[model samples]
Target chain A: AQSVTQLDSHVSVSEGTPVLLRCNYSSSYSPSLFWYVQHPNKGLQLLLKYTSAATLVKGINGFEAEFKKSETSFHLTKPSAHMSDAAEYFCVVIRSPGKLTFGTGTRLTIIP
Target chain B: EAGVAQSPRYKIIEKRQSVAFWCNPISGHATLYWYQQILGQGPKLLIQFQNNGVVDDSQLPKDRFSAERLKGVDSTLKIQPAKLEDSAVYLCASSSGLPGLATNEKLFFGSGTQLSVL
Candidate 1:
């Protein structure tokens, strides 16, 4: 089954520094992948998605993910981290007809 | 536009009790889903409904779990004889198009209902 693995369970970055959340995927074929973020007491919001379009996908809030098939990875990156970026982020991959498998999640912390 | 709506932001019940969670998807959405997120883990799908019909419930524990979308707009998930392990956040989501079947489709989510089963 298609699934994604978030290499880091928690990532901490100083404010204004670059942010990188690593994610590796396992699938026999090219798959649809997504990045979702959840804030405290809020819904999970879509960050971005890769649907076999351009290898590089830009999403809301200055976030982007590059689909690297050769490396089987779709890592989320931001040029500069902000305090508001602290939250739990999930990596999702569509497996079956209605199945979207989610990784354990990566909690991002922004240090002042 | 209004996002998915879920009721009772929090619930606390003893094990073996029965509890139900309600959800109202965005107007005009055809697909609704229920997911359970345990602390420190990602959300897991419980059931899915497409226009008042069951699309998927493979992961739902049918023994004590049940869900329904009667009018195809609002949904309810019930857990009878809740277990200690049932403590988690119940999330409701809706999409205008088929979710996993369509690669580009997106889902609107609710804040979720936190259930604490003692």
Candidate 2:
């Protein structure tokens, strides 16, 4: 069985400050991890993915995530926060082909 | 490259009523998925299809929830005799190949149909 746990339900950060959203996973096999972002009334868009290739994965909009096998963690981060970054973030784990188990999402709020 | 397309962006029905949602994946996408997302929660996979064949539907409520992708290009999910708990956003996603086979392939999602059961 494979599952992901997002550590925070909601996170608030000031503009120009750094941002971090934590996630942990449990997978029996080598797992593929992904971070997706969803704005209000919009569908999910892929931010980044890790497939046993690179531990530090960079994504669109200056967002990135690091895959830590030892820690069972894949935490998403950004160098600085922007107003447009406010959205719901989901951490997903896929152990088998075409099967994805998603975490309970983290809501990010950007403060001006 | 057009994104996945879904219909009935919003729907409202009474409990025990039936509803259906449709999806059209991006061109050349061979895999499709249906997910249920409740308020404040992540999207949960209800079913998956490869072309016109069913791949995984272990989590779908078979008694009342059914889906089909007749031509493998478009799909439909139907919920008969809906329950109050079924009120949520239904998202349709598609990928070019079997997901894990390629590391760079990602699921493209539609805006989703929001179902509200009264």
Candidate 3:
């Protein structure tokens, strides 16, 4: 079985500040991890994915995440927060083929 | 490329009523999935289809929920005798059902249908 846990339910940061959203996953085998973002009334958009290659993964929109095997963590990060970054973020774990499990999303709020 | 498309962006019905949602995946996507997302929770997979064939439906509430993807391009999910718990977002996603692909094959999701049970 595979599962994911997000460290925060909501994260607030001011514009231009660095952003961090924590996520941890557990899987029996080598798992595929992903980060997705969803804005209000919009569908989920893929941010990035980690599949057993390159500990450091870079994604779109100035975002990145590090896959740590020992810690079993895949925390998403961004150098600077933008107002447009305000949205709900989800951490996902792919246990098997076509079986993708998602963690409880973290709602990101950008403060002016 | 165009993204996944879903219809009836919002629907409202009373308990015990029936409702249906439609979805059209991107061109040539061989896999389609339906998920139920409750408030404050992650999306749960209800069913999956691979080119008009049922792939997995273990998590679907068979008693009241049913889905189908005919011709392998468009799909529909139907709920009968809806319960209060069924009031949530119904999300549809699609991806290329290829073999031995691990990471780059991303799943494209639609803007989900918001179902409200009164």
The sequence of per-residue lDDT tens digits that candidate 2 reaches over residues B73-106 is: 9999999999999999999999988734864468
C-alpha lDDT of all candidate models, in order: 0.93, 0.93, 0.93
lDDT of model 3 at position A95: 65
Task: Write model 3 residue lDDT over B33-91, tens digit each, in one string.
Answer: 99899999989999989899888999999999999998889999999989999999999
Judge candidate 3 at residue A37 and give its lDDT: 97
lDDT of 2 by residue, A14-104 (tens): 9999999999999887788999999998989999999888899999999999999899999999999999999999999875776778899
lDDT of 3 by residue, A47-100 (tens): 999988798999999999999989999999999999999999999998666678
lDDT, candidate 1, A15-60, per-residue tens: 9999999999999999989999999999999999999979999999
Return the TM-score for candidate 1, rounded to 2 decimals. Answer: 0.97
| TM-score (all chains, Cα) for each model | 0.97, 0.96, 0.97
In model 3, the runs with Cα more than 4 Å from the true position are none
Candidate 1, DockQ to 2 decimals? Answer: 0.62
Which 10-residue window of candidate 3 chain A scores lowest in summed lDDT?
A93-102
**Better model by TM-score: candidate 2 vs candidate 3:** 3
